[model samples]
Target: MSVATESVPVFAIAPAEDGQIAFPPAMEARFRPGLAAVHDEMLAREEVIALLCFGSAPRGEAKPKSDLDVLALTNGTEYWKRSRMINGVEVQLQVGPLQHWREDIEKGNPAMIDAFATGELLFDRTGEATALKRDAEERFRAGPAEPGPKFFQRQRYAITNIVLDLEDMAEDSLEARVLAGFMVLEALRFWCAAQRFWPNRKPWVMLRQLQGRDSSLGAKIESFYTSYSSVHAIAFTDAVLEGVGGRLYELSTDPEPVPS
Candidate 1:
C-alpha cells in the first residue's frame, strides 16, 4: 500500500561509547553563546528576581532541534504578553511575581513545577528564585499533590469504559479499531492524571517510561504491525492493559474481559 506511517520525532539521544549519556558537547557549543546573551540581558533587569537555563539544554542531552526554556521569576505584578525567541532558540521568559509562580506550582502546574524542580540556576541575584526552586523540588518530590479520591474514581470509570470499547473494536473494522486506539490514548491521559505521572510529550516516550516498570513493554507494544492491523490493535490494547496492571495505582478490574 502507498499509505504512509508517521515515525515519532527522533532525538539524537545517543549514549557515548562509555554508555554515559549527558549533554552532548556539540549542542552546548552551538547553543551556549545565545543562552549566555539572554541571561545577561534578563539579569540586568531590577524586576527580574530569577533566571534559569532549563529544559533540554540544561539537561545537557539537547539536540540541535531542542529549544531552550528559560524561566524568569520576577517581582512584576502583571504577566508578560509572551515568550520571546533568541538566535533561533525559543526562550520562554515567564515574568511574574515569585509568589504567583509558587501558587501555580502548589496547584500542580505540571510544566512549571517540572521546570522549576529540575532547572539549572542561571542567575539568582536575589537568591529568591533559588529558594523557590528548592520549594518546587520539595513539592514535586511530594508527588502529584494528592489529586483526591474523586479523581481516581473518575479514572477507574474511564479506564473500564475505554478498555471495553477497545475490546469491541478489536472485532470490528480497521477504521473502528483505529478510532478505538485514539480513544485508548484519551483514556491514558486520565490514567496518567490519576498516577500523577508526567504525560509523555511524545507517545513513544511512554513506552520507555513503561519499560522501567515492565521491561517487556517495548516488545509488547512493538508486536503491533506496520499497517496497524486488528491483530496489532488487539495486541496493543493488551499491552496497554498489561501496563495498567503493572504501573497504575489502585486499578479497578476492567469490566471488559481482561485481554488474554
Candidate 2:
C-alpha cells in the first residue's frame, strides 16, 4: 500500500446522494441499449456470470457523448476474443481465464464486485453474481485506505496523466483544447485529493481551484469556459500557465513523511 514519493496523483469525485456517482442521465439512457446488447452476447457465450456498467454512465456524470464502461465477470476467457469489432468500435473487454477470474475475485480486484454491488445489474444468472457483489461492497466499505504509500500509489497514474494533459493544451487543435481543459481539471482533482481536499466535478470548482493559483486564468475560464464552450477556457488556460512561469508542482521530493 506504500506509494513512491513520485507516484501518480489520485482524485476524488464529488459524493452524490447515497455516496453514488454516475454519468449524465441522457448519456445513461443512450447506453442502456448497448448494455443490453453486450449482455445478450455474454449469455450466448454462457461465460458471463454477471454484467454491470461502470464509469460515468453508472455514476450519473456522463456527457451526451460518452463511451460505455462495462465490468463483466465470466467463468473463463475461452469464450472471449481479444479484439472483437463490435459495430466497428474496439471495446476493450478484460477477460480472465476461468481460474484467473476466480483469482481476480480473491485478490480484491473486485472491479466486477463493485460494479455489481453498487451498480444496476443489467443481467445476472444463477443469482451468485448479486451475492458476490454484496459481499464485495461490504469489504470495500469496511476497509480504510491504508494511507501514506497506499494513497500515493493510487495517485501516480493520475499525476502522470495530468502532466501529459498539460502538454496537450499547447496544441492548436480544437479537440486538443477541449480535452486539455478536462485533463487540467482532472489533474487539479488529483492534486486536491492527494491533500484530502475535495473539489466539485463541475466547472465552478475548476474556476475556484484555478483562481487560488491564478486569478487571471480563473476570470478568463469563468467568463469564456462553458458547458458549450471549451475554446475560451483553453485560451485562458494557456495564459494562466504562462503567467505562473510554469505548472504548479503540488508535491515535494523531500522524502520526509507528510505531517499529520
Candidate 3:
C-alpha cells in the first residue's frame, strides 16, 4: 500500500497521511480489501508497471451500485480484462500495454483520455503513468475537434436513410418504433459532435450534458422519451437535421478513382 516517495509522480492524486492512495470513502469502505488483493496480485507480476483507478469511484460520483474500474499498465503485447464480484460490487480490471494506452490518448480516444485525465494513480513504478495522465489532461482541456464536412456528410447519409425507412412504415408499427430508436441515437451523436462535446455512454450523464449545451433540444428529447410518441420522435429528428442543413432526400458522392 506504500509507494516509493521518489517514484510517485507530482501530478498524482494525493496520498493519505499513511502514504496510501486516498480513495473516496464509499469506495474505500466497500472495495478496500478487494482492491488490495488485486493490487498485490498485479504487483507480484514483473510486467505490470502501474495501476490506476478510474470511473465513478475515483471521481467521487459513485452510487450504491457503482463498480470499481482499474486500469493496469503493463509491458505485454495483448489487451485483456478481468471481472470479479466483491461484496456485491463489480471489480473490473483492464490490462493493456503502456505504449498502446499512450497511443490511444494521443489519438483522442474519448474514454481513454477521460480515464487517464481524472484517474487516481494507485501505483507508479516509472512515472510514465503520471506523464500519460498529464498528456490526457492537456488534450481534455483543449476539447474535441470541430466537426468537419466529412462528419456532417456521414451523419446526414445515415439519418436520411433512416428517415426514408420510417416514412414507409406505419407510425405506431413495431418497425417504426425500432427505426425511431436508431434516429434518436444518431441525433444525439450528431448534436454532441457538433457541439464539440465528448459523447458519454451513460444515459443521465449524456442528458445532463446535452441540456447544459442546448436546453430546447434537450427538453424536446426528454419529452419524446416521456411520451413515447412517433410524432415527437420525428419532430426531434427534424430539429437535429435542421441544424446540419436539413434532411437529405438525395445524396451525391464523387468517388476518387483508384490509382493503378
Candidate 4:
C-alpha cells in the first residue's frame, strides 16, 4: 500500500523549532538514512500499520556497536524479522500483529511493554500505536503483578541448588566461575522480581537498575564480577536469599490426596 509521507504521523523524531531533527545529532547522522529506508520498506506493505523505534538507540544509551531495534506493527497474523547492516549499524526489524503486541502489554511482557511505553513512534497509520503506547505506560506505572509465593519458592529452590554446586567445585575452576556467573544473574532476576521491577536483559542495564533500587546490593554484585572473589559472590547470594526468605533446604509441596 502506498502511503504519503505527509499522511503518516511522526511522534518522536519531529523537526525542532530551528528546523533541526529532534534525535541526538550523532545518532541522527548514523541511523537516520537507514531508518528512513526501513520505514519506507515497511510502510510500503499493505499489512504494516505502525513502526516503533525502541531499545538502546531511542533510550539514548546506545553504544557504537549497539543495534538499532525497530518494531513494525502489522495487520497480518504472521510474524517476520529481519536484520540488515545499514551505515555500519545493524538494524533489527520485527513485524507482528497489533493485537499480539497489545496482548503482550496486557500480560506484562516486560520487553513489549517497555517498547511501547518508551519507544519512539516513527510511523503511525491509524493512531492505534498512540493508544497502545498510552496503555503500556499506564500498565508500567501500575507495576507488575506481585509475584506469587510459588515464584519465590521456585527461585529459592533453584538458587539453593546453585549454591550447593558452587560449594562442591574448586573456587578457581573455570566451571565454578561459569556457575558463579549464572548464580549472579539468577539472583538479580529473583531480586528484581521480588521488587516488582522488570529485570533488564542487558547486564549493565540490569545492574544500573538494581543500583537504583539498592546500592549496597548492587555493589556486592559488582564486587563479585570485578574481583571474582568467592567471598563476594557468597555475600551477593546471601543478600539475595535474605531478601527472598533465605535459603531453601526443603521445598514445600502440595498435600497428597487421601484415597477412598
Candidate 5:
C-alpha cells in the first residue's frame, strides 16, 4: 500500500464453469495428481481445513515445467516447511499453522495476501478459505496498508546487501555476474512487491506486470534478461535499480497514520 506511489491494482482470478480452475495442458497433466493428492490428504483428515492454489498454475500462465504454489491451512499445532516437492514438482507453501495466515497479514506480507486475493480457492472446508479471503479483499479495497518499519528495513537492507554482492561478483568472470543477474532479478521482484505492485509469484509474470506499470522499465529489464542473458551484469543491475529510488522510498517510510 504505502510501498507504491502509483495506485496498485488488485488481481483476482474468477473461476471457470464447473467451479474448477485451469492450468496449461502439460502442467495439468503433470500437476493434477499432486493437487489431487493434496485433495485426498485434506479429505482424509479433519485437521486440514483449507487448500489454495495460486501463482502460475491457477492463473494458467504455467508452461510445461512450471511448479505449483499452494497454501494448505491445517490444524497442526506448529508450522511447516516453506517448500516441498511432490512428484518432482516444487510446491512453495507458506506452510505454517492456521495462525500463520493471520501472521502473513500482521507481518505486512502483501504478496501473501495478494496471492489469496488473486488466487483460486481450491478447497474450502465449510467455506473457511472463502470467508477469510473476502476479509483479505476488504482490506485490499481499503487500500494498501503500510508494511511498516521492519518490512521497509528488510527491503532496503536486502537491496543494500545485493549491491555489495554485485561488487564481489565484479572481480570474477562472466559466470559470476550471470549468477548476480539472477540475484538482481530476484531483488527487483521483491522490490516490486515490497512497493505493493503485487505480481503473482513468478519471474516472467512479474516482469510483465512491471512492464505494465512502466513500459520502458519493463522493456529494459526484459532486454537484458533476453539479450545479454546476464552477461552484462553491471548494465543489467543498473537497469534494474532504475525501478528503485523513486516512490518506493516514500511508500516504505511514510505509512498511513494511526489514530490513537
Candidate 6:
C-alpha cells in the first residue's frame, strides 16, 4: 500500500508530556506582535467586538502545522480580515458573527472555550471574551445533559461512521477507531450532559461508568481501544448497538421502544 496518511494537524490537541507542551518563548513573542497589530487595526471597527485564538497553538503543544484559530466576533455582516507570517507559517484571520460565535461558546465547545480560558489573550474589548469564558465555565459546572434529539442524531451518525471505520481498520489501514471512541464518548457525555451529569473529558471516566452499568460491554470497548484492533472494535460496536436497541431512538427521537 503506497497510500500516505496525512500528518495529524498540529491544531488538533492531544495529550502530551505535561511540562513539555507549550509554545516557545520566541514563538509567543513573534505571534503576539502581529496579533497586537491586528488588534490595533480592528479595534476601530464598529461591528467587530471580540477576538480570540483557538486550537493547540494556544495550549502550548503546537507543532509546525498548527492553524492560528483567530475568532473575529462581529456584530453583523461586516468584513474583517487580516494576514501575516508568524513563526515561519502564513497566518490568516477569520471574522464571524458574535451571536453565532457565542452560541457555540455556550454549547461548551471544547476547542474555543479551552483555548480562551487557557490561551493567552492578545486583545480584549466589549468584555464579551471574558463573559464567554465565564459562561462556558458555568455550563461545565452545570454539567453534561441527557442525550436529546440533537445528541442522538449526532451519535447515530457517529456510530454509522465508526462502523465504516472498523471495516477499514480490518484491512490494517485506518486508526479511525481512536477517533470513533472519542465520538462515542462525546455522544455519551452529551446524553449525560442533557441529564445534568458532568463526566470528566477522560476516557477512564466513561469507561468506569460503562463498567458499573455493563461490565462485559465495557470490557469489549476497553479491549478494542487497548489492542487498537478493528475486529475487536467492530464486535464491541455491535454489542453497543444491540444494547441500545429501542432506547437508541430515545437518545435522539421520541418513541421509546415497546418491549418485545
Top lDDT: which candidate number?
4
Task: Give lDDT for model 1.
Answer: 0.59
lDDT of each: 0.59, 0.50, 0.78, 0.79, 0.60, 0.55
Q: Deviation in angstroms for 142 in model 1?
A: 2.7
Question: In candidate 4, which residue pairs clash?
Answer: none
RMSD of each: 13.4, 12.5, 4.8, 6.0, 9.0, 13.3
Give the poorly placed runs of model 6, Cα more than 4 Å off: 1-37, 43-49, 74-84, 96-100, 103-120, 149-228, 235-260
Global CA lDDT of candidate 5, please? Answer: 0.60
Evaluated at residue 161, the lDDT of candidate 5 is: 61
Q: After superposition, how far is residue 246 of candidate 4 from its true place, in Å?
A: 1.1
- Give the alpha carbon lDDT tens digit for every residue of 1-260 in model 4: 11124433455333222322344333546777667678777766779877888887877778888888989998889988899999898999999999888888877798898888878877666777777887888877877789988888989998988988898989888888888888888888788888888657777777778899898998899899998866677789989999878999888868879998
User: What TM-score would each prediction reach against the true structure?
Assistant: 0.69, 0.45, 0.83, 0.84, 0.58, 0.49
Model 1 scores a TM of 0.69
Best by TM-score: 4
Expressed as tens digits, the lDDT of each residue in 76-145 for candidate 1 is 7877734556777665555667778778876768777778887776655555666667777876787675
Write the number of the candidate with greater TM-score, choosing between 3 and 4.
4
Q: What C-alpha root-mean-square deviation, in Å, does candidate 2 show against the real structure? A: 12.5
Q: Which candidate would rank higher by lDDT, 5 or 6?
A: 5
lDDT of 2 by residue, 1-260 (tens): 21122322222121212322333344445565555566556545556665555655667766655566665667665544344344433344544443453445456563544544456544545454555555556655654233475345445544444555646554566766567667556545544444333334555544565678756655666665454244554455445344323344454444667789
Can you write out model 3's per-residue Cα lDDT over 57-99, one digit (the tens) per residue?
A: 8667788888889999998898999999977779999999999
In the range 50-151, model 6's lDDT, one tens digit per residue, is: 666655555555566655656667778655566667655556787877667566656666545554555543444455555665566566555444456565
Give the per-residue Cα lDDT of candidate 5 at 86. Answer: 82
Residue 77 lDDT (model 5)? 75
Rank list by lDDT: 4, 3, 5, 1, 6, 2
